[model samples]
Each structure stands twice: as structure tokens, then as C-alpha cells.
Target: MSGQQQINFEKPFIGSIDQGTSSTRFILFDSKGDTVLSHQIPLKQYHPNPGWVEHDGLEIINSVNECISQVLNKYKETNIGEISDIKAIGITNQRETTIVWDKNTGKPYHNAIVWSDTRTSSIVNRFNTKAESLLKKEQQSQSQQQIVPKDYLRDICGLPIANYFSAVKLRWLIENVPEIDQSNALAGTIDSWLVWNLTNKKTHITDVTNASRTMLMNLATLEWDSKLCDFFDVPNSLLPKICSSAEIYGHVESGPLAGVPIASVLGDQQSAMVGQMCFDKGQAKNTYGTGCFLLYNTGDDIVHSKHGLLTTVCYKLGKDSPVHYALEGSIAVAGAGVKWLIENLGFANNSKEIEALANSVQDTGGMYIVPAFSGLFAPHWRDDARGVMVGLTHHTNKAHIARAMLESTCFQTYEVLKSMEKDSNDKLVELRVDGGMTMNDLLLQIQADILGLPVVRPHNLETTCFGAAYAAGLTVGVWSSAMQFHIGKRFTPNPNIDHMKRINDWHKAVSKSVDWVDK
Candidate 1:
């Protein structure tokens, strides 16, 4: 597998704990980004109220341990290597999920505030109205906030004070929870909490990529902006020390695989960059999980989009390493459309079935289902946009709705990618895609046709886990370089009828679905 010099067959295996919003997965990868084995466990989510999302932090930690144990145990029978030869582990997680835990006891003080949680809108309103002095401090010091002519946290973070990030969550906790307010509470995102748990509470740290999303880190400095910390009413002591994405964050002390070094912590989107091997400026990738995320590599320059896209850290190699910046956009709903179909509409029994049903229809049959369930995002930024269907005729049945649901996701991505191209002027010609929805050929084809670009999907669809494994593998000298990995597969754009006309009608359908925002 060597591009030049040959090495022995003794490459150490690297494991990754990809704790995401939907599930927890443990993936083991060899040096060349090839999967050796894997295990995944679905996580339980609590949506006790609208816009209030929570998860058990202990469940998150235990799932990681359980997956590692399961994968290692199963790998014991493989002759490729022994369990004892495993080198290290890397972690990539859904960023912005907030938690407050005891520094001494390692117990979560409350359920984690998921990245999707929108419980802090009123809190944000209060800050925007009352905390002008504090907001100014943050605006000057925080790099992302600074990128915009000020008032840019929502612009550059692809988030708002409305609670999809750690900052407002921390603010809400500190204000409402009595225990956290009066003590030295350890407050941080999922990465910080997991790093703490893994190191036996020895390391309370997070990487630059994760930090940038918090509306706390200065994009340029890659450090916690002291002013923003104060602006968000977060005590300086409560935050985690920021580090590089690829350095040794901590080491495992006690677990199914103890004593292994933990390196390469990344937000899931950034990790997918490492997985897709998007190393150059203008390279872009879109992930279709519960929601859709499009990220374009902008090199070191943070473009600070006028459109509703974010300037965030793609990855930080080290404390002193040059940070690769990215422009990111988030859609309100994607695969959640399929979930709604199954759970609410009785269209299908499972998510995988939606692909076949979507394929059954030649067209959406003049129907459109804009899934603005929570709100619209990206260039639209219409928090008022609510989920609604338009142009539904008698012929518009389950298949058409399935197709429309799938097309809705692509259109949302198309909007973001177009905005990304305009903001960075990169003109994305190809996009690497991963996550659950990429498994759908019908969806991928539609994505290709609509975007008028090649959509490359890797053989190992688990890009998030693979990226973490790659990072860890590099740190331990297992996969010395990611450049050696081969391109697994490519799904090119297919010819469609009346491209311009189809686009017009599709967009026309979209226009009708508006005005439903928050009505």
C-alpha cells in the first residue's frame, strides 16, 4: 500500500469514538483509512418540550466504552493484529452539546444540552437587549465575532444565541441552575466532557474546531476569547483549555482499552474533511445526517460571509499550527423529513425504505414539502419558516412526498453551496458526501443532477468515525500520512430533462412553501 518506501506488516490499529447526535459508533481503521471493524449503538434523545433537546452524558460515555469493548473483543479473532497491538484512540463528536459537571467527582450536574436545543431564544433576546457592554467586549475580542463588522457570532458560527451552541447553554445554566452558579462548575461542550471522563478527570480540554463553534473562541487567535466569555456570562474558569485538533488531548486511564493515547479531537463536520481528504482551498463536502451541513475549505482566510454562512476552524493541527478555516451552512431539517414520514405520516416503517419509495416516482408530481420544522437556516436565516407542503394534488401520493422530502434536502444544500461559491468564489465543481442519507442512490443522483456536479461517496460511509481514526492513526505513527488513501467511489451527475425548466418548477414549488415560517 506504500506510495514509495515499503514498511513492515506491523502497523498499529487506531480506534475512534464517533459520538454523534443520533448514535455512538466505534470504528477501527488501518493506516490507509480502510475500516478494519466497527460497532454502533443508537443513543436515546429526550425532547421533553419543543426546542428543548437533551441527552444523558453518562449514556454517551458508557456507549463509547461499550462500543470499544465490543469492537476489540470481536477483533480478537482476526489474524490482522492482536488487541494488545492497538496503538491509540481518536475522538470526534457532535459539537456544541453542552454539559456542566463536577471537576472533582466527574458527575454530570444535568442532562447535556444538545446542539439542536433552542431553549435559549428568550435568553438571547435578553442578552441582545441588556448585555450591550458585554456583547461589545465579545465583538472586539472573539475572532468570528470580529470577522463580521461586529454582531457576527450568529453569522460566523452558523448559529445564534438561540441555543444550538455551548455559549448560551452555559449562560442559561449559570443563570438558572443554583449549583452551577455558586461553585467552580466545569462547564463545556461534549468534547470537553468526554476528554475529562476519558482522562479520569485529568484533562479538561477541547480542540480549536470545536471551540470555534462555541461562539466563544476567537477565530484568529484560536483561543477562548476572554471578552466573549464574559459577554456570555461564562466564567473564565469554567471553560476548557483549547488545543490542536491532531495533538494528544489526553490518554485513556480506565476503560475497555486503557492506557491508549487520545489524539485528534474534532467536530464531526471537520473530521469528515479529514475523512474525505479535502486538503486544499475550494474543496467542499456535504454531510446528510439528521440535517445537512455544507462546508467549504477557505484556507486561512475567514471570509465572514454576508450570506448566512459561518467562518469556522476546519481543523487545527497544533497549538501553533496554521488553522484551516471553513465556511459552513446548516439546514433546519433533512433526514428528519424521513423520520417525520415514518413516525407521523405513516409513509414507511424505516428510514432506509424512503429511498425506494422516492425512486418510485419519476417526479415530485408538482408537490413540495418544505421541512422548516424548526426554522429556516443559512442564507434564508428565517427562524419564522415552518414546515409546510404546497401544490399537493390528488396524484401527489406517498412516493411523490418521499421524492419531495429527499429533494427538499438537496435544494437546501444547493442554496448553501451556491452561497458558499458566491462568498468564496470557489465554484464548487465536486462535493464529497457522507452520513446516513448518502446511502440513498436516488437521493445522491438527485443531488448530483440539481447541483450539476459530481457527488463522490466513499465506500466506507462512516466518514465521521474514519476521520477520527485517521487522526489518531497519524498521531501514533500508524498511518503516517493520510495522502496514501485511495478514492473509493465517485457518483457523477446524470443527465436530466429540461434542466432549467425543472429547476424553475422546483424553485416555484419552494416559493409557495414560504410564509409558513413560525405562523
Candidate 2:
């Protein structure tokens, strides 16, 4: 369970650049999939307006470089492994976070619009109107009845027309940022940004997993659809070339790890699925980080969610390998909620102290907190929704609120799981989990009790990084196949706790949060 362990200096290692929403990390994994060394740097978030989130693209890339330098220095200090021992590097990044930069200068047009930002709500509304008119025209041509607007491209992209996707974000930037010229600008998610900089701007590419989340790539063809590009009014020239998750896209141009082949790239959640070894159909994993994401592997089949979930690319190991799809339910808030408690509400000094404070109370005193801060994501994609805490009384204290905040994450996760089962038509025997929040034993126990299923955590909670490492290692022959990873902890459902009533109460709180923002 310890990240520091005796190293086999003679073997090859895989380096993973895990660029996430709130931070960036560089981790080196040995042939056994164990963490050899790692370094992390916290990222700065900007909110000039409400419901808006942004990250400085320059700062992000700088932080990434700093992490690489720090980890490399630490690696050399060990005197265990030579720099050349790292045969390949991989990247897993926060998906849907759009960045537009000059193709020639490599300068971002503006701050990277975060995935959680809702500033593009107006753009979504405009697109919905246009889509409805198009649908009506098509129906009239076919001699069919006209209907309300629906997810017109969901069949193609496996995503709804929402502000959560990169297309919408890019549209927002194009409309607002007058200086950007579509022909001279390039747009992509975080993975593309890092890969471009890491290779000294020699490459501009994105893996299938990251491209799928952009709402531009066709789920069936795995390519950027011209029709979609036209619909969003985003130029295809602005996009990065899509590639497989595991391949040598380019090499590190300058660094201690320079000349290393950049072998693999995946969206963070999908990478966790790989790290969890959910290769078979129906296997699922939930990651609790800045947000919570649950992905259910559907093997080669793309199962569209009748319920409110997204069908996305799980992984495409190589150019010739068959594509794997997944049903994903994204929660906008999880660890971020805990963070809000510390930075905004002053609940505790840190997440650990908040857990301690919550344990002081037996329950939330009949309270419920619906963290619809950036609006609800899955099952309820309401951009108008806002955060709400109901069932408060004179007796409610900080302890009660802390418990409610923690319970909110568990409750949201349970809803997503139910939706996943409905879409897949198969029940998950156990839920595999990884992320920073999984370190909180109370939260995991509550997650199990709420779902009435066992929650499993791997000994290495850094599954996000490990997944990238696994794919990169596999590509370079550092590892021949998936290695066995042991489970660290398991929490079974509490037989005595009947959570139905509380779940129902939580639903009521969620309902109260919606429609707070007028159209």
C-alpha cells in the first residue's frame, strides 16, 4: 500500500502525466504496476463570474513541467533507476475541459474553460432552438409529425446537447473571444494541450477517449463528424488528429525524460477503468476526485443510456484493436463539495478534519444537502439548478452539516448506479472505487450502505495514474499483459440501515434546487 518501495533499477518504468481539474501529477510505475516515484502540483481555479470556472493554460502546462522535473529529481536521488529506464510516457487528463490555442504560436486564446463551468448555458439554449427547427424541417420532409427538441446528435456522439461537452465550450469561446481565428486556432481537451507542450509543440493529437467527450467525434466511426462540426460551427481544422489510447504519438522533446516515447492517452475516468482491470463486459468502476465519475464497461458494444447517462469510449488500446465503450454517469460534485466546506464554509481545516467532525454526529439530524453547484450532471442535466440544503432545524450544527455533505456524495453515486444498471440491464455485483475520496473510510461505508452493495477499493488508489502506466507499458513491451492488483479494503452494506426514506428525502431536496436560475 505504500508508494515508496524497493526498486528494481534494471527493469523499465512507465511515466504517467495525470493532468486533472485541480492539480497535475507525474508518476513513474515499475513493471509490477507499483508506484516508484511521484510528484504533484495544485492548480489554481478562476471564477470571475458565478457558475464559471477557468484554469490558466500557461499555468497548467508549467505545473505539469514542474511535476515532471520534481519527480525526475526524486527518481535520480534514489540511485536506483537511470533516466533511460523509462521507456515510454502516458497521459490521462480531465476530459471536456476545452483549450483553444494558436496553431503557430502555441498560445492559448483564453483561460481554459473548465468542464464544470456553466457560462455556456446560453449557447446550449441557442443550439437547442436551432436543433428543434432542423428536426421539424426533417420531420416535415418525411411527412412525419413535428415534436419537441431532443438530443439530436446523441445517437452519433452518445452525449446530450449540454454545456458539459467541449463543443459547447468551444462555441462559447468562439462567440465571446473576438480575437480567435478559427483557421489559425487549435482546440482540444487537456490531453492534447499537455501532449503538444510535452513534445515541444511537435504534435497536436488527442486519443479516442478524450475526443469522444468533445461531442464532436462520432461514436460509430470514431472520427470527427463533419455534420457535427457544422452544427456546432466549429471548424474541423481546429481539432487535433484522433489516435488510439495506446500508441507512440510522439516523444518528450525536452526534460529529464526527454526522448521517451509518449505511448498512451485516455480520459481520467476511462483510465481508472483500465487501472481497475474492467476489461470484461458489465465490469464498472467509480472514481471520486474533484468530481465523481462512474463508468460501466459494455465491451465492444456501445449501450446508449435510456436513462440520463453518457455512452463514451472506454479505451482503444491500439489502431487495430477493437474499441471498447462505456456508460458513464458524471457527478459534478464530490470531493469538491468537501473542498467547499473547508474553503467557503469553514467547516474544518482539511478533508480529514471534516471526516472527524462528521463522525461526531450519528446522523445528519434529518438534513440533506443537494450540491447542484454547477447544476446536476447525470439523470438531471439542469443548468438552472443551484445548491440547496434542506431539512435544517434549530438543532442543526456544523457536525450535522458535515455529515450531510459527506452523505450527499454517497446518495448521488447511488442514483448513478441505479441508472447504469437500468441501461446495461445487468446488476453490478460489487462496485470498484478509486480516488482521493476513497481514502475516507466513513464515506466508503456510507456509499456501500446507501447502495446495499459492497464497495471495493484497490490497494493502490492512484488508479488514474496506474491506468496510463499500464497502457503505456503494454505498448512498449514493459509489461506483456495486465498485472494482478490486490484489493485494499471492502465495505459491505449495513443490513440494519434502511436508506429508502433518506433517499426519498434527498430527492425532494434536489427538486427544490432546480429552476432557481431564470431562463
Candidate 3:
């Protein structure tokens, strides 16, 4: 757990690339789902304008290659034969972070529009206006008709018109960047970019899980919808071919990992769900990363969320297997808000220190930080929302602010969990959690206290990588099923404390955060 462990050449191994918003990591996992070797590089984010975030697409690919090379090189010194032991490589990446590149030269046309970027809010507003106009026109034409209120692409895509999706980002690039034209353009999420690069451009493909997040893929058909594509103005040719989550897409043709089959690709949140072994309906997991994502598995049935949750494909194990569906509540900011407090405000030097600083105070001292930085996601798809700190007083200090920061994630998560229950119609018995934020015991305790449910942490915090590895391992027969991981720790809700008042106050703070920006 502390450092790179020596790998055995005799045993089969799986490599995973976890390309996230904050960092790019390559981890080598043995057949038992234990990390044998790992390397991580922090990614630099560029904020050239307000509410706009971009990442150098080339730099992201370079970080991925560097991580792969470093991890493989370390294994080479310990066991040269182990390089051949790598049976397959899997990928899990930040979903909906849009990237467009030249198909021939292998160069990105512009910086990657990150999932958290709000530059396309104007574009989203345009779409919302168009939808409203169409609905109004229909209502005027038939006053006596029982007009079923048509949800704008919700039935087909399970997403509303929002800046968080890849469609709006792609549209923005096509309209704004002159170089990104139909002649030489190709658009994809971070998963597609990584796979296309890793396979030496032989495979321009994404799995069902990654595709489902695009707001372009049809949830029922599991393919790109032409009508949706035409509506979004993204050419169907620019999109990657959708594939099953567990299949050999291509082989790595360069570097130390040449010829290793690329067998799996999953969105990070869906991968975490798989890594947590939430394969059955009603099972759920919350990933605490740069942002918080809570996914509840609904098996094969696609339940259109009556609540604000998005319905998405969980994973498809095989080409012919029934595709699993899930209801997801994506919180726009969790750890990123924590990072903002640490680096921007100097609340703490390191993220782990926030716990002690926050614990210094008995509570937030009636303070609440609603981190609607890029607007609220999930149940409330309000793009106009912005970050708000309410209930501040003369007695409020940094410790209270720190506690409020951590509690923001808990409160956001609680709202999402409630929405999930409303959609699934089943109470989530316990919450299985993994990711970097799970390392903080105080955060997990807060999660349990807020939700009034037991919080479960896996033996490995890097379950995002493990989930991709599990998919690849399943393809190459490393493991038959995802039954290897065990519970490392559990935090049950405290019955002694009633948190309704605190939660109710947090809701008031969130209300103030919404609609801060008007179109």
C-alpha cells in the first residue's frame, strides 16, 4: 500500500490507465486485483476565462504515456519477463470531457473542454430556448390536445441540455474554432482520446458506458442517434464507434507495451461501480474524487428518472450480453472544492490536513459552502448556479470554513442519494465508496452521518483503475467474475445525532447558490 511491490513474472497481470481531471495514473494489477506497481502524474488545468476550464490534450496523452513507461520500467528492473506477463490493458477516464483532434496529424485542434467547464452555458441556453419555443408552438397549434410534455432528448439520451455533456462542448468547438472543421475533425471524450493514442490510432472507439455519457448515444439502441447528432450539429462520422465495455478494441502498437490487447474502457464512475461489485439492481456506490458521483445499478431495465438523475449504461460484459443500466447523480464539485480551499485560500497545505483543521471546530459554526462552482449537477441541473458560502458570522473562522467545505460534498451526496432512491424506488441499504477522498476518515464519517446509511470502503481506494482492470481481466480470463474485492472498512450512521436541521440549513444555502448567473 505504501510503495511499488515487486511483481511476479509467472503470474498474469493487467494494466489500467485512470485518466482523471486531477491526475493520470497507470497501475499494474495482479490477477488478485492488488496493485503491483503504480505511477501518477498531476495534470495541469488552465483557466483562461471565468467559468472556463481547459486541459492540453497533447499533455494529457503525454502524461498517460509517461505513467505507462515509468511503471513498466520499474517492473523491468525487478522482472524483465514480467513485461510479457501483461495480458491486457484497460482504461477508465473522466467522462464527457470533450477533446477534438486532427484525424491525420494526431494533434488536438484545441484544449480539451473539461467536464467541469462552463464555457458552453450559452450554447445550452440556446438549446433550452429552442426546446421551449418548439413546445410553445405545439401548444398554440393544439389547445384542446392533451399534449404530452416532451422531454428534450431525455428519453433518447437520459440527459437534459447542459454544459456538462460532450455534445455541447463539441458544438462549441465546431462553432467557435475555425480550424476544427468537418474536413479534418474528430470528437471524443478523454477515454476515446487515450485509447486512440494508445492503439497508435488504429482504434477510434469507446465502450457503451463512456458513450452513454455523451448525450449523443441512444440509451435504448446503444448506438449514436442520427437525429440527436443532427440536432447537436456534431457529425456522426466524428463520433467513435460504440463497443461493449469488456472486449478487445485494439492492441498497443508502441512503447514498452506493444502488442498488449486493449480489452476494456469505462467511464471512471461506472468503473468504480464495477470495482465495488455493484452488479445487481438496487446496489449503489459513491466515488469521492475531483467530483462526487453516485451510481445505482438498475440491472438491465432502463428507468427514466422521475427525479433529476441521469440514466446511463453501466457496462456490457460481452458483445451479446444484456447491457446493464444505472441511475447516476453527478455532483459537479467535491474534492475540487476541497482543493480550491487548500491551494487558493491556503486553508491547508495538504488535503489530508483539512480533516484536522475542520475537526478543530466542533462544526461549521452555522456556516455552509455550496460548491456549485460549475453549477449543480444531478437532481438539480442548474447551470446558472455558482459557488456560495452562506451563514457566515463574526465568529466564523477558517476551521469553520474548512468544515463547511467537506460538508458540501456530504450534503451534495445526500441530495443525490435521495434522488436515486426516488428513481430506483428502492432504499440504498449501504453506500460503497472508493477514490482518493475515501482516504479521509472524517469525510466518510460525514457521509454516513448526513445520509444515515452505512458507508463501506473497499480494500483498494483505486477502484476506478481496478474496475477497468476487472473488465480487462474478465476478457482475458484473469478472473471469472468481480468477486475478489473485500470490504476494508465500514462507517455506520450515528443514531445519537439528528442531522435533519443541519441538512435543512444546507438546502437553504444551496437555494441561494442557484440562479446566481442569468442567461
Candidate 4:
């Protein structure tokens, strides 16, 4: 199945660990990016306070270990291959989820702060005020000719001091968790945490793609910016040394596949971009997971956004290769909104059933659901926004709400696409899509109708995992390039519906959701 002319091997394979917000999984993939074997485990999330979300850091490590063991055990029983045949391992994780641990003990100080958590909104506000005051002081102390424009760290980091990024999360931990303030403790995102444990603490490193998500890293230098670290009050020593996305970071010191080289690492969304084979400029993909993330490849240029989108590294194959940048549009809630309907509102017995339920209704019946559950992300970075449903009448049933929920995801993605187009000035010919939600053809149709653009889904919906595997395989020469990724399905735009009215009604509902909670 490999495109390269290398000698074919029956036993050699690549392994990947996809640690996502909702679950942990270990997938064994062949050279063609097809999953040969896999084991998945659902992760438990704790919400101890309103707008707060966390995951047990140890639990994350344990889950990864368990899945790897289970997959290898099954491999052994089937006599397909030995653990030694797994040439390399790759890792992709939810970005910006902060974890602080004792450097010596390897014990986390507190639960890993999830990217969706809004506990640091107040801290972000305070930091913004401090930055403004400092800027004003500089302006007053200097003449107009001597005044230097302050880009507010955006030009360097390509991010804002928002709760979604890792810097604010790390700052919050230092203030709230005393153990974290100790000199022995170090802060890192999930990739660094997993890499540390996987290599038996022999290495503390993170890929540029993951590091870019933290506000501490400079986009151009691809290293922790001292100015940013000082502004955030986080020591540079606390961060992992940044590495390329596809180089061997370290060898696995202990596991079923002990001694296997951990060759590649990427942030989950960046992995999806690679898996989608979006290597050229203007190519884009939207992952419909717990949240919807749309990334447009801008080649090597780091195009700063006039809109609320973020500029981030897409991937860097090696230290010598040029860094590919992307414009990212994040929607806080997508599949999670469907899960909320299923578990919280009893709209369906399973997430898959939502498709049939939504299809039961001809339309939403004028209902508009604004899934601002974790506040709006991307173009509208409103921390105070809350979920709202407008045009709900007595005639509205669960089916209508279900339809509206699916439509909410589509509308949000449409808005982000518009923003991306505005910032990049390049219209998307088609959107390559992946993730669990893409399984629902009805939802994809809704997405295509709303955006008036063709939607393409890869044969392997688990591109996030495959992307990691591909990176690892590339490092070990499993395949020459990611050009092997081919389209599985395509949904063309059927823009017959009056989408303008629906979008207007959605905006009206969203307006009510803004500033819902008082400070």
C-alpha cells in the first residue's frame, strides 16, 4: 500500500497515540494510513466549578499505557507482528491543556487544565489591563517620534492572552496551586507530559506545532520568547525545549514497545492538517470533533489576522525544513453540543441516532440554537457568551432541537470560513473534513448547504491519529510523502435553502448570549 518503491515488509508498522479531550487511543497503522489495529478508552472529565474543566494527568498517562498494551497484546495473539516490528511511535494531543508536575517525582501538581476551561478569563482580563497600562506609560515617557507601536505580543506569538491558550492556564496554576510555584515544578502541555513519561523522563521536549499554541512561543523563532514568558511570569526553564514535528525526540524507555523511537509529535489539529495532506497554500481542513477547528495552510508565511483568528504553525517536518503556517478558526463547541443534547437533554440514546432524529424533521422550524456553551471562539472571542435557543415555540420538538444543534455547528463553521477568507483573501474551493462528527452525512450536507461550498471527507475519518502515524512513518521512511491521502466522500453545495434567514436568526440568538454572566 506504500507509494514509495521501498522493499515491502509484512511485519513493520507504525503506532500512534491520539490523546484527545474525550478519549485516549492507540492506533496501529499500516504504511497506507489505514488502521490495522486500535484500542480506544473514554476519558473522564471533571467540572468542579462553573466554566471549569479538567482531566487527571496521571489518568491520561495510564490510559495511553493501557491502550498501547491492549493493542500490542491483540497483535501478539493474532501472530501478526512482534513489538519490535513497530518501527516508530507518534503522538498527537489536545493542544494548550496545561499540566504542571514536579521535575523529580513526575507527579502533577493539579488536574490538567483543559483548553476549553474558562477559569482564567479574569486573569486574561487583568493581564490585558496591565499590558495597556505599560503601553500607556511607555507612550507618555517618550516623544511622538520615539513612540514605538505595541502589537501586544500578537506579532511575536500570534495569539492573544485568552483562556484558550496555555500561558494564561499556566499563570492560573501558579496562583492557585501552591505546589506548582515550587522550583521543582515544570509546566507543559499534554504532548510534553506524555513525551516525558514515554521516554521515562529522559527527555522533556515539545514539537513546534504544540509550542505555538502556548502564548510563550515566538512564531518566527519557534522557541519560547523570553519577553512573553516574563510577561506571563512563567520561567523559561518551566517549558519543554521545542523540536520539529517529525524528528525522533527520544526512545520509549518502558512499555510493550520498549526501545521504539518516538519519532513524531503534533498538536491534534495540526496533525489533522497534515493527515488531510494540506501541504500547499490555500488548502484547508475542518475537523468536527468536540470542537470545530478550521486551519488554512498559508505555506511558510505567518499571516497575522485582522479578524479574531489565530496564526499558528501547521507543521515542520525537520529542523532544516521550512515551517508551514496556518490561520486557525476555532469553534468551542460542536460535537460536544450534540453530546450535550444526547446526555443532558435525552434527545437521543446515542450520538449516531441524532442524525436520524434530525432527519425526521423537514427543517428546524425557525428554531436557532447558539451553542455558546464554552463561549464563542475565533472571530468572536467573547468569554461571557452562553448557550441560547431562539425561536423556540410550543411546536418545537426534540427533533427540531436536534436539527438546530447540527445546524449550529454548520453555521459556526460558516462564520469561521468567512473570517478565514477575509483574512487570507483566498476563497476555499472545498473543505477537507475529518473527525467523528463527519460520520453523519446529514451533518455534512447541512455544512455544505450553509457554506455553499463542497465538503470532502477522507476515507479514514481518524486523520488526527493517522496524521501522527504518517509523521512517524515519514521519519522512518515508511512513505516518501503524505500524497497517499485520497478523498473518500464529497458533499457538494446545495444552497437552495434560505440560509441568510437562518444566519440572521442565529445572530439574533447569539446577541442574547453575549455577556450572559456578570463578573
> Could you give candidate 2's per-residue lDDT for residues 379-489 as a string of tens digits?
788888999999999999999999999999999999899999999889999999999999999999999999999999998888999999899988888877767868999
lDDT (0-100) at residue 400 of candidate 2? 95
Instruction: Give the TM-scores of the predictions, in the order they appear.
Output: 0.91, 0.97, 0.96, 0.96
User: Tens digit of lDDT per residue, candidate 4, span 1-519?
Assistant: 112222333547999999999999999887656677889999999999989999999999999999999988887776676777799999999999999999899899999999999999889888888777777776678732332222377889988668899999998898998766567877799999999999998889999999999989999989888899999898887888999999999999986889999999999999999888889899999999999999999998999988889999999987777899999999999999999999998888997899999999989999889999878898788888899998989999999999999999999898899999999998999999999999999999999988989999998788999889888988988878656668899999875666888787877888888999775
Predictions: Cα RMSD each: 4.4, 1.6, 2.0, 3.2
Residue 43 C-alpha lDDT in model 1 = 96
What is the Cα-based TM-score of model 1? 0.91
Q: What lDDT does each candidate get?
A: 0.79, 0.91, 0.88, 0.89
- Rank the models by TM-score, top first: 2, 3, 4, 1
Can you tell me which runs of candidate 2 are displaced by over 4 Å?
1-10, 143-150
Best candidate (score: TM-score): 2
- Tens digits of lDDT, candidate 3, 1-519: 124545443368899999999889999888777788889999999999999999999999999999999988887777634567899999999999999999899999999999989999778878777777766786788773432232577889888788888999999998998987677777899989988998888889989998998889999999999878977778898998999999999999899999999999999999999889899889999999899999999998988988888989999987877899999999988888888988899888998898899888889889999988888888888888889999999999999999899999999899999988887778989999988888999989988999999999988887899999999999988888657559899999899989999999988998999878877
Clash pairs of candidate 3? none
| Poorest lDDT segment (10 consecutive residues) of candidate 2 | 1-10
Q: List the residue pairs that clash in candidate 1.
A: 143-218, 384-517, 384-518, 385-517, 386-517
Q: Give the number of the best model, judged by lDDT.
A: 2
Give the Cα error of residue 431 in candidate 4, in Å: 0.3
